[model samples]
Each structure stands twice: as C-alpha cells, then as structure tokens.
Target: MTDPPKAWDAELVGKWLERRLAAARHDQAAADRRGYEARDDYDKAAAEEWVCRALQSPDCTREQAALARRIKELIGQDDYRATGIYDDIRFERHVRGHLRKLAKMTKANEGFEKTLRYQ
Candidate 1:
C-alpha cells in the first residue's frame, strides 16, 4: 500500500514564497543598475569588439549575436537607453504567477491534510 501524503503549513509556505520573491526582486534591481552603469561607460569600439568576440564564440546563441549587433547599433547612434534590456518587470510577473500557483497547491494540500487528520 502507498503511504499517506505529507502535510504542509500554508502560512509557512506563503512566508517562504514571499521571501524568495523579495530576494529575486532585489537581485533583479541590482543587475539592472549594474547593466545601466556598464552601458553608460561603454564605447563604440568596445561594443564592436564585443560583437566580434561573440561572433567568434561557437557557443554563442543567435539571440546573443543579435543583441550584440543591437548594442553596436545603439553605440553608433549614441543611444545607451535604447539598449532594449532589463526584463525585471517580466521576471517579477512570472515569479508572482508561479508563487500564486504554489500558494494554491499549498492550500489544496492543507485542506486534504486536515481531512485526513480528522478522519
């Protein structure tokens, strides 16, 4: 016979998820700031060199090469802000959606556990 399912504390799970979300947000913000600062200090020759290096790398993805080309274009136009980077908002939304799904699963499991205990 199969063993019974384990019980989980919904409150504890919620708290853990919240902490993870906060950490992810903080990390994303730090990365965005770093990227912006790096772009500010970047030059056309540096961008071109990076693109050349990327093109030479066998492991570089098409998306990465495309991004490198875009960076070179931005450098030529003197438009650092148009780098088309920073997916923090999208990442946060995905994390929140995943957390919500986990919360729902936890709630369902808690209800099942309560039913099992009472029986």
Candidate 2:
C-alpha cells in the first residue's frame, strides 16, 4: 500500500516548481545579455529596437519605458527569488533594464507605434 503525502512534502514540491521557473528565466536572461553584449554598435542599436518588441504590453508608453524597464527587472527579480535561483545566479538587472531603456528611447524619439506587435 502507498502512504499519503505530507504537507511539508507538498510545500517542498511547490518550492521546486518556483525554483525551476526562476532557473529557466535566469538562463534565458543570461543568454539575452550575452547576445546583446556581443553585438557591434549598429547591430546593438537595431537589436535594442527588437528588444522593445518584447514589451508586448499595450499601453506601454514612452514615459513608461524607463519605468517599464524597472518593472520588468522587479518582475524578473521576484522570479529569481521565488525560484531560489538568486543564490547561484548573478542575474544583472541592468542587462534587461538597459536594453528596454534603449527601446523606450527609440519609441520616444520615433513617436509611439500605432500598430505595434502588442497592439
């Protein structure tokens, strides 16, 4: 016969799920940083424009660009903490933050998109 699962075990399982999600995000974030860091000036600029595409957030505003970047970092940080990956991971908030900041700058300079991917 099988025994019933304990509450602590269930909690442990929940923690494991959170940690897994965070670890995956950390890995993805690291890759994104490397990709951004490896580009030349013009490529980096264009890549920055692509990065803005991730903002797939409707209502994403020029003024909210910097703030949006901040929020994205916070959201990622919360993911790191929740997933217990912050200890072994050195997820630089500035990587994503700066990338998004550039995107925001581009949008602000170019004027808001009327039909962005998110729109």
Candidate 3:
C-alpha cells in the first residue's frame, strides 16, 4: 500500500512557525519596555493576572499566583520527560485538572463576592 500524502507542506509549516516566532518576539519586546527583567517574569505576571480574573477575585493570593506560575512552567514543557509525567496523555490530564480547579475556585470566589455585595 502507498503511504498517504502529508497533511502539511514544509513551506507552509515554516511560514506558520515564522509568524509565531515573530509574534513572540514582538511580545517580548513589549514586555522589556514594561520593565520585566525576563520573558518568564512577564509570562508569570500575566498568568497570575489571568488566574485572578478566572477566579473572579480582585487580587491573586501568594499561593494562587504560585499555582498560575506553575501552570505556565508546565505548559512550556511539552512532554512528560520534562514535566515528570509518565506520558503525554497524563501530562495533559494533569493540566486539565489544574484548570478545573481554577474554574471551581473562580465560582466560589464569585459566590463570596455576591455574598459581600448582598451584605
């Protein structure tokens, strides 16, 4: 049997990667202008802010911010070998669990905010 045709051509893939790299570089430059010492610092700060918003909370607690940073770190490592997971599937599942936890926390925080508003 003949092998199937490839879904993506090399040129197309290269162009896609180039666009992504360019966007990443632009973001890095903006972060530098904003006084972030490193790209990771900028990413962590953004993640912390996202986490706080997802939780519907006014501010991120130290632990919540840490969790957000951890999530970012885990995300950059695409495989189990780097993240200590047994397999890729497990790694994705782990990340999904963390996301679910964030959602739940957000719901609880929203309720708390509502309670405060009512009182």
**Top lDDT model:** 3
lDDT of 2 by residue, 12-69 (tens): 3223323433443444455557665432332323332323344333434223444346
Runs of candidate 2 with Cα error greater than 4 angstroms are 1-39, 62-97, 100-119
Instruction: Locate the minimum summed-lDDT window of 10 residues in model 3.
Output: 110-119
TM-score leaderboard ranking: 1, 3, 2
C-alpha lDDT of candidate 3 relative to the true structure: 0.39
Question: What would the TM-scores of all predictions be?
Answer: 0.32, 0.24, 0.28
lDDT of 3 by residue, 39-66 (tens): 4534533333332333332232323344
Ranking by lDDT: 3, 2, 1
Query: Each candidate: what lDDT?
Result: 0.36, 0.37, 0.39
Candidate 2 CA-lDDT value: 0.37
Poorest 10 consecutive residues by lDDT, candidate 1: 110-119
Give the per-residue Cα lDDT of candidate 3 at 80: 30
All-Cα superposition RMSD per candidate: 19.0, 18.2, 19.1
